[model samples]
Target: MFAMLRYAPLLAIPAFSSVAWAPPMIRMVLLMAVAWLTVIAAPSLTPMPYWSDGGGLLLACSSELLIGMTFGLAIMLPQAGIGMAASVADMQAGLSAASLLDPGGQHEPETLLGSLLLLAAVVLFFTLNLHVQLFHLMAESLRVLPLGAVGLRLDPEAFMAMVGSSFLLGLMVVAPLMIGLFAVDLAVAYATRSMPQANVYFLALPLKIAAALLLLAATLAYVPALIERVFQDALARLPSVFGA
Candidate 1:
């Protein structure tokens, strides 16, 4: 138990760097500590196995780690896809020129709008206590899908269906911004077509930026609701993802 507790911090390294307000090493250790506590307390709250001895223990631990990672990625994939899609849209909107290097990943040209949206999502997660809820859901997952049951039988069709649905959910979350941008684009195109010599290049740039900003501001009110729905759907489908 002591040894397992000591090793708990290793699991948190990934999460530490993704958020702000901590040095890499410290955050890593802190995150690991959190994971350790959760895992240690998990079996008591749920019907999970405590540590076992022998070679099979290694296999069990590895399988648990893998399952945890898979579930984490499953939750994160939609957010990553949305961020990428928003970045692409920002690029097309001429906002790529204002890109900044994201510290979370190497050589990634992060867009201002996308970053804002991502930050907003994170804030909403915490403000609504979704993070705690996620942790609780994860804890319950151990009961539903134990260590040895990590890579359980999953239907490929259902797995694919879930992935497809997740993508659509991500798209819907960003749909409002996309629609606003599309409308702006169409209006700009019509104006340019009507008057090609009106220096639309210079005029349209600021207009589009302003319009995008306005849309983002207006849509801000809906972000918490959208994020809640996305998270709820993701959590609901987690058991299916694990083949339970």
Candidate 2:
């Protein structure tokens, strides 16, 4: 339970187990209760030869915690990709100023285009059962890197590669929209220059939003495929990312 609790937030990223909105005290109590239940239900889940001197137990706990964190982080990379795509699209659409406080207590940009895309991404995530896949990956990780066996054995290069690839996937998802928005920007610029007295900045926002929405609606069919590909790529890299 403790091990799982250490990584619960990571597991919660996909919306299934998130408790970030709860009061801190309530959240802690809930987590502790869950952890206790988990331990009670699965005694073997803990590190072998659990009883030890204080220093040894501390080392064991640290190693297990590290393992949980690594697995959790690896599972979270694809979601980061989703956030990246939304952020860039929001920026280009001039919707960066529109913001919301999410359940995690973070201020997130909230735009029509970005919100739509984020919703699509999340829907596809659940549709593809990637959350289940992540759970399985986490389980597999335990087999490959057992509790208290050692500290995380991540390869820096592999980790960087995963990060780079995830970001690239995000860029790919937003590429077409970006190009369309860029053309819109050029048109707006030319129009503004030709008519110096016009409120072009104000005018551009609506135009950009319209174009982004149109493009998004037109290309909506392709989003599932893009999301699926990114998800699969992330799943494929999970084993290497966690040294599984």
Candidate 3:
């Protein structure tokens, strides 16, 4: 149980993503396997044996939950950035009306281009072995956030800054593509001035999509770099989440 608390930051990752890729039963088995490995790997990671005291145990659990959530949120920020950038691209390309139904998670609707970008980012996440790095980070966090410590100090301004930086990273990734699409819109707008009978929006949609698709193809070479830049920034700021 203590090990599980330590590993709780990773809990959201699988919950959000792996559930879509792996079956629930498989995920459970894998989770149990991971929990066992974590316990075996760090047998000395237990909190005080005095945790049997109800109130103390509650405090410890609450602290762990809060801290774990903070760390998990830090790690997930890059994924959020990807979603933001994709949404911008989709909206710019006039594809916001078209959505893909997520097969997992209650069949929620997701923007088509956004889903594609997210899927690519997830693939790159594993390809870059970030999962392994995440484990290393989790283990390292145990040092600063040892169990049974019930105190938390958070810097609101630092957190707000991190959020802003995350969005900026997203914008960096899609800026070129968006700029091209904006140019397309400008060109279409000027050309449509002569043809008053044209359905400007309807006609512009396909042109923007084609331009977006082309820009995306050109943009693909940079996605690995995008993931690298965003995650690097996010991970570097992880220790701050504990609040200096």
Candidate 4:
């Protein structure tokens, strides 16, 4: 029970993060699958025998939950890079105003490119077998951070670095599109100045969108490799985050 409880958040984050765009039924199924996986692993995991007292046990569980969530969050952030890049690209392309509710969560509206990039990230996440690596990391964390001792070693610096790197990766992925859009903007500006009567705003929207799409398609081949590299970096940083 403790082991399952400890890993529940770790399992939940990746499972849900990867499939956030999926239907509720699909998310529920993945979650259930993770639950079973955790349960199966629980028997082999070491239990915290020192936390015999109620207060100590409660604290230990709390620590475990926090640690698991941290680990999961580190793993999940790289997948978000694609969405961030898309958001910036959409804004540049004038598609920011045209939005759709993100299927993964109800809170935010996503642009078309943003949605596609998000889906791509999720697909890449699975294709690269990062989920398997995540599970392996969770199991190994037991050796680094034994139960009851987890909460003390939380590394805020490492977490912040993880987040910063994810954003940087996102920017790298979309930099080409952004630069192309900027060039388009420059062309539109030059045209508008050359012909004062022309409505550049009207012409710019479709042109920018077209350029963004073309650039995106052109760069699509490299996205998986970028995602894989960023995700692997995140995974490599986990031990430091846990103070291992």
Pick by lDDT: which candidate is best?
Answer: 4
**Model 1, C-alpha of 232: deviation from truth (Å):** 1.7
lDDT (tens digit, per residue) of candidate 1 on 1-244: 3223222322343542234445667755666666677667756533235335566556566766655555565556556655766776686567877655445656767787678767776677678886677667666765776535434555567557666766677677768777888888898889999998898867888877887778778887887787677666766776776676
Our tally of clashes for model 1 stands at 1
Which of candidates 2 and 4 is the stronger one according to lDDT?
Answer: 4
Model 4 alpha-carbon drift over 4 Å, by segment? 13-17, 20-50, 100-107, 148-152
- Give a tens-digit lDDT track for model 4, residues 1-244: 4554566565444462444555657655666776576556544546556577788788877887777677667656876776778788899998886754345756667678887877777778778898789878877766666545535577889888888988888788888899999999999989999999988888789889888889988998998888787788888888877776
Q: How high is each candidate's TM-score?
A: 0.76, 0.77, 0.85, 0.83
Tens digit per residue, CA lDDT, model 3, 78-140? 778878888988988978766543345455657767788778777877788876787787667
What's every prediction's RMSD, in angstroms?
4.7, 4.5, 3.1, 3.6
Ranking the candidates on TM-score from highest down gives: 3, 4, 2, 1
Q: By TM-score, how accurate is candidate 4?
A: 0.83
Per-residue C-alpha lDDT of model 2 across residues 1-244, encoded as one tens digit per residue: 4445445565433342323445666766765664565445443655456435677667666776665565555545666777777678878987775555344535544555656766676778778887778667655555565545545677777778887887788778878888999999999999999999999989789889889888877877887898788778867886676664
User: In angstroms, how far off is 96's CA in candidate 1?
Assistant: 1.7
Residue 46, model 3: Cα distance from true site in angstroms:
7.5
Off by over 4 Å in 2: 1-7, 12-51, 100-109
* List of clashing residue pairs for candidate 4: 20-104
Q: State which candidate, 1 or 3, has the greater lDDT.
A: 3
Candidate 1: give the clashing pairs: 9-32
What lDDT does model 3 reach? Answer: 0.73
